[model samples]
Target: MSTVKRWTVDVLVNDDEGRTYAEACLHSGEADTRLVGIGRAKLNPADRDIPEIGDELAAARALCDLGQRLLVEAANDIEAVTHEPVRLRR
Candidate 1:
């Protein structure tokens, strides 16, 4: 059998002292699968000011971290059920 579900993610950024912090929240619809991840980027005082660039970089980092974590959890679950190591596919 096959099924489909929808997941949602929201990212928010905060700026302080040339630093941008982004937090990503992922909701998997299931009660036990909510996840949150955070990432940070710093702007050099000598460089040109570009808020959008910083926001994009920070948000992308946060999402990548979140994806890594989710994959880890999935691997753990697979190992627990199968009693074997999981070699994640590339």
Candidate 2:
């Protein structure tokens, strides 16, 4: 039998001073797991003041971190069941 599952990810971005911060949170109902990823982008003194660019960069980094975390979690779970070391590719 096949089962259907739903997962959601929430991303929040904030800009303060010359820096931007982003946090990505993942909600997995079936596994009852919550994962969080954080990212930050800094504006250089010579760089232009573009809020959108910072937001995009920070959010992208956060999502990348979240993806890596999820992979690690999955690898751990697989190892737990297999009783051996497991390596997951990105």
Candidate 3:
């Protein structure tokens, strides 16, 4: 028999600059792909096929990567303002 699973995904950020962001998500109607499954808080890849965890973490990773790029861009801006070397070594 086939099985359907549910998952919850959450994102959180709390910075020292008095800023906070948080989100929670529930995903349903998800089928066992013979490639993936669901845990209490994450959608994980199936053990026989993929065996990794965290769609949520994967999304967070992409966001963090973009954030790092933006941070470097901001630093480059500051360097331009101060005539400093923009060593953007991404």
Cα-based lDDT for every prediction: 0.88, 0.95, 0.42
Best by TM-score: 2
Please identify which of the two predictions, 1 or 3, would achieve the higher lDDT against the true structure. Answer: 1
lDDT of 2 by residue, 33-55 (tens): 99999999999999889999999
Q: Which stretches of candidate 1 lie over 4 Å from their true place?
A: none
lDDT of 3 by residue, 1-90 (tens): 996566443444322222223233323235321112112223323433221333344445545554565567668778979998776555
Better of 1 and 3 by TM-score: 1
- Local error of candidate 1 at 31, Å? 4.1
Consecutive 10-residue window with the lowest summed lDDT within model 1:
30-39
Report the alpha-carbon TM-score of model 2 versus the true structure. Answer: 0.94
- Ordered list by TM-score, greatest first: 2, 1, 3
lDDT of 2 at 59: 99
**Which residue runs of candidate 2 sit more than 4 Å off their true CA positions?**
none
Q: What root-mean-square deviation over C-alphas does model 3 reach?
A: 19.1
Model 1, position 63: C-alpha lDDT score: 93
Badly placed stretches (over 4 Å) of model 3 are 1-54, 86-90
What lDDT score goes with residue 16 in model 3? 25
